[model samples]
Target: MKTSTVLIVILALAVVALVARLFFFSKSTSSAASAVMENLMTRTSIRAYQDRPVEDEKVEQLLRAAMAAPTAGNRQPWKFVVIKDKQTLKAISGHFNTMKMAEHAPLAIVVCGDMDNTYPADGRDYWVEDTSAATENLLLAAHALGLGAVWCGIYPMQERVAYLKDLLGLPENIVPLNVVPVGYPAENPKPKDKWKPANIHYEKWNGGDSAVR
Candidate 1:
């Protein structure tokens, strides 16, 4: 179930990847962008973490990477809550059944979407999209920095969302998106094989074998 949950979190981000690229990442051959791509490809969800504490400077680096994500209309509507307190982390760990790693992780960043800063577009909220993009950036940054991490979904799951809000003392207008546990890796999980020509169709999606079965 933990593995499936991780995969679900990944799929959710991947679904918005095209939109992310369209708004934030540009097609570039520069060494920096190339290095970023390398990090993206090799990053894997880390579920087990060491007992050591994560440095403050490294936390700042991850936040910087998250803020660098593209926001719709430059709204940049994201509020981050960093959790380091052992009791608080243990409380959160106990509450979220799938996030046992939080108990051992030195840091957990709760990414929230500031509804006050988001505007309704076509009668739909875009805060989720903007915040999710930021979350993906953060995960990548963690991997690049040699810190293991995991993305545990919170928003859209009303019960989990409310629980985190009360635990973290977030305002009603702020919605907790997810909990990211950060620390040195204690376990290394293998990456899934996602490159499939069966799902790829040039020009337009040919309704042939392109369906994800």
Candidate 2:
């Protein structure tokens, strides 16, 4: 073959290889991304709890599952204050924006992140994110066990956090993330579909409709 003809043949083969690589890479990425979205969408939050008290063994299992969640750098900076006391539960309920369910919940698990344990000498606090993950795991585990749970915010609310600290005798290093009130669900709340077509963007932020499957 002439040199010019040989060059054209080589370039054509290179283009075919590049196209094949791009197609497979795109398919693999799309499959992995879809799996992640499905897992996230299946996890739902519950609030209406039944009068049944969670067993000690079950509580321990739930806590173990919660602590198993991934942490930033595996710092494991979170701590939990489990409240089964009725009077204490009532007191904490008073601080909540909505307190109707506090009277009925069998127990409350106060999720706290230790800022002291999370610090890496950079003066940055990763405790909030770490503890949030732990709290979500706790809630998910509760739901999986046929229990109901509600996440009531506490940390950033200075007054509520201070009250909980004083009530629970929490150390200065510990920052309360939220109180998860848990029990067997008294009401089975229907899960709402929060999927919005316009909220999803493909490859770029074109504000196009979500490609709902």
Task: Give residue 40's error in model 2 in angstroms.
Answer: 6.2
TM-score of 2: 0.74
- With candidate 1 superimposed using the best TM-score fit, by how many Å does residue 189's alpha carbon deviate from the native? 2.0
lDDT of 1 by residue, 73-112 (tens): 8888999999999999999889888998899999899999
For residues 18-68, what per-residue lDDT tens digits would candidate 2 score against the true structure?
999999999999998986565456556566676677999889978998899
Each prediction's TM-score against the native? 0.80, 0.74
Query: Clash pairs of candidate 1?
Result: none
Model 1 misplaced regions, further than 4 Å: 1-34, 211-213
Candidate 2: segments with Cα more than 4 A from true spot: 1-44, 121-123, 207-213
lDDT of 1 at 192: 68
Candidate 2 contains a number of clashing pairs equal to 4
**Best of the candidates, TM-score:** 1
In candidate 1, how many Å is residue 108 off? 0.2
